[model samples]
Target: MELKKILCAVDLMDTVNPAVEYAKMLADMSGASVSVIYVISSRSTYENLQVPVEEIAKGMRRIWSRSREDMDAFVAAYFPGVDATGFIYEGKPAEKIVEIAREQDVDMIVMGTHAREGLDRLFFGSVANEVVKSSKCPVMTIRPEKKSE
Candidate 1:
């Protein structure tokens, strides 16, 4: 396939992920531009915050700023010597990822899956699963290799 753009969704929780490498490989082969996206699942309005409005806004800005920093670091660490765009958004991760992919007209999306099961899966929905279901373009999900006992 002739891929012009790719969106790679990464959660900063993990120090490393195989999905990044997969994205890089695909981009290298297809000559596609890669865009890294990280979403902060935070409520838009901090209704519970008793602090002043300015303080609340400032706090939100700080959080976003830190996220941007982390995104930059993640991109640099994962995609050395390669130019990649970074995007940070505040909202549900799956929705935001799909939205960004659509907006950017990406040809494919690459992301890592935690492989949560049973009760954990029920409690915390799978962002990868949701993105695959909702995304307009093809999505590639990489699950980390299981350690041998």
Candidate 2:
């Protein structure tokens, strides 16, 4: 299919790198503009830093700045010359991804899934599963193969 726009939701973990790669390949094949979204999961604003608001904003900015650079590097290496946008938002990951998909009208929602053990699944939960269940558009999950195991 012709994918004009794609929303790639990343959790900024190593395991999710394959999802980014899969989206890059699809975008390369379909000539789609890629929007890479990373959700901060909305912590309590910030910890008491004993600093000014400007400083806090600057800190947040720095964090996002690094994220942008990292994503840019990955995109450049994989799918060069494709128009790309990276975003950082604070909220529940599944909700933010769905909201961005609705707002941007992306053709596909791409994300990653981890094989969770019993207790990990019990506590941390599955953001990918939630997104798959709730997203307005089609959700594509890429489970990268494990090398050693």
Candidate 3:
């Protein structure tokens, strides 16, 4: 299928580069535009009850601002001189990703897989797995390269 636009979901972590590079390669090959998205999960916004609501909100704002800067740097690093738009959304990560993909009408969704297992996977669940299952469009997941000993 011809890809006019591609949606890339990143967490602005170590996994981001591989996913962004893969998406960039695909976009270059297919002559498609790329849109990068970072989701801030609602659960991440919660803190100690004694912190106070105002403090929580202020902390969230700081987090958002820092995240935005990181996102900008990420795109610049991976997609220099390319016309890629970056987006930030707040909610459950996988759900927001799928929703944005559908809303944007992208041809494919690109994301990174952390390859969690056992208890960790069971407790936290896999965002990539959820996105793959729920996304209306095709999902391409790039696993981070194994680090050498």
Candidate 4:
């Protein structure tokens, strides 16, 4: 397929590098421009509020600022010399990813998964799983490599 644009979903965690690498590889092969998206789930940011609304808002701002820094660092580290645009979104990760992919008209999506299965998958629903199910374009999920001791 002739890929013009590629969307990469990253959580800024252990899976970030592997997912970015996979996306970069695909983009290189297909001559596609890569855009990286990092979603900060509202559930984690706005839940269990024990403080005032202003305090909550302040906390969210701080989180967003930090997330932006992390996203920039991630791109600089893993995608140096590549023109990768980074985006930060607020909401459920899976939904935000799919929305961005569709809005950007990306040819494909590359993301990383923890590879949770069985009861784990049932309890903590996988974002990658959800994206694959809901995405209009093709979704490619990569598993992070295990570190050797």
lDDT of 3 by residue, 13-43 (tens): 5543458888898888888989999998673
Candidate 4's C-alpha runs over 4 A off are: 43-45, 49-51, 147-149
Off by over 4 Å in 3: 43-50, 147-149
lDDT over C-alpha atoms for residue 39 of model 3: 90
Off by over 4 Å in 2: 45-62, 147-149
Task: List model 1 lDDT by residue over 71-103, tens digit each.
Answer: 888888888766588888888789889999998
Give the clash count for each candidate. Answer: 0, 0, 0, 0
How many residue pairs in model 3 have overlapping backbones?
Answer: 0
Candidate 1: stretches off by over 4 Å: 44-58, 146-149
In model 4, how large is the Cα lDDT of residue 124?
84
Task: Give per-model TM-scores.
Answer: 0.85, 0.78, 0.89, 0.88
By summed lDDT, the worst window of 10 consecutive residues in model 4 runs over 11-20
Candidate 4: C-alpha lDDT: 0.83
RMSD of 4: 2.6
lDDT of 3 at 99: 94
Question: Which 10-residue window of candidate 3 scores lowest in summed lDDT?
Answer: 41-50
CA RMSD, predictions in order = 3.2, 3.7, 2.5, 2.6
Q: What is the lDDT of residue 139 in candidate 4?
A: 90
